[model samples]
Target: MIDALPPLREVIETHGLSAKKSLGQNFILDLNLTSRIARIPGDLSGADVLEVGPGPGGLTRGLLAEGARRVVAIEKDPRCLPALAEIAAHYPGRLEVHEGDALEFDPRLLNGPVHIVANLPYNVGTELLVRWLTPKVWPPFWSGLTLMFQREVADRITAQPGGKAYGRLAVLAQWKAEARVALTLPPEAFTPPPKVHSAVVHLTPRPEPQFPADPKMMNRVVAMAFGQRRKMLRASMKAMTPGIEDVLVEAGIKPTERAEQVPIEGFAALSRALTARGL
Candidate 1:
């Protein structure tokens, strides 16, 4: 056991904390598994960690036990507060729990070097990741991210060009950070197992984007191209500007290439060409 406190199963039974499907809650009761997830971000000894949807504080305890300097956990569910409070008391000034939507919580309030590690609520995982990847500032507050997502989403984040899984997510993630699937967990690992398996993705933000392009414009370009993945770039992106083929040629991209066939650098170049033409 990593802690002197009662086992997670006992805590849940005592608190009557059954997993709620509405909140995308799937509690991991095993400390060993939670601890292993915590260790994936490497040494947390000197960093403050940000966690979201910490249902019953399973990963919270793992972080503390693994020696995270401080953990700021944002939990939307009110039922988990008392259980998390128990952990805060156990750790004595190491764990902080906030009862609210993680979407509203601001990590900038916390002192850096912050590393975000969470068993993210499945409903909001992709949205949260997009927010983190596209912060207003070039380098976001968090130094790294270790997040759990459905296996398909994981594949998208780590995918390369010319694959079915590659699309806007791959472009966005790879443009901003170095991302990889660090761990995969079976469905049975949770208290109320989900239908699909989950994987943990680790991302380290780059000092700058892989290539320079207006952020908003790049996103718009990517969105338009992938909005019809089967269509060639010329057909799919014609709505982007009057001279789409000229723009594609200037970017060194073939107009006949589909969105899935265009690499991140290719998209970046397209974004730049559009910007140059004042699109």
Candidate 2:
């Protein structure tokens, strides 16, 4: 048995908690699954682990048991607080529970040298990922992001060039981090099971992105290009300028290629070209 906390089921039942579908909650009641996710980072000995949507403290307990120096858990659901409080009590000063929305929380202000490990709520997973990926600074506050997402979302995040699944997400995530699917879990792993299977994704921020380009510019170019993904760049980028072909030439990209076929570096070059053109 993993030490440092009570079993999650006892905590949940004691707190009168049931997973809420409205909040996109699919509680991981299985201690084994939670332990696996908590251990995905390889070693957590002295790391400050940031956990989001720690429903019933299943993952939270695992983090402590796995030897995290401290855990700062941000949870929006008030109903789950009692359960988390029990874990906090069991662990003493090692656990810090924040009662608020994670999207609005700034990790920089909390503590230094953080590592994010969470089984993110399905509804806000992608959006939260984009926010973390687009920070104004290079080498974000957290050491790395080890998160769980629906398997489909995981594929899109780690997808390579020249595929239907490859798009803005692949470009953005690949540009700044090395993301890989660490493990996959079936839908039956959870209490109130989600329809889609889940996967744990480990994303370590690179010291520098493969190509350095303005993030705002990259977002704009990718949005425009992938917005009409089926069309060639000459047709898709028509709104940017009538000389869209010239822009592609300057960026060292083939105007005939569709957005999905281009690598992340190609997109970075396009963003740079667009910036130079003042577009």
Query: What C-alpha lDDT values do all the predictions have?
Result: 0.94, 0.89
Error of 1 at 193 (Å): 0.6
Model 1, span 1-279: residue lDDT tens: 998989999989988899999999999999999999999999998999999998888899999999999999998888888999999999998998888998888776688899999999999999999999998988999999999999999999999999999999999999999999999999999989999999999999999999999999999999999999999999999998879999999999999999999989999999998898887
Q: What's each prediction's TM-score?
A: 0.99, 0.96
Writing each residue's lDDT as its tens digit, candidate 2 over 4-92 gives 46676777778877888888888888887788888888788868999999999889888998899899999999998887887888888
Give model 1's TM-score versus the native structure: 0.99
Collision pairs in model 1 = none
Q: Candidate 1: minimum summed lDDT over ten consecutive residues — where?
A: 102-111
Give lDDT: candidate 1, residue 62: 97
Total residue pair clashes for candidate 1: 0
State how far residue 40 of model 2 sits from its true place (Å). Answer: 1.1
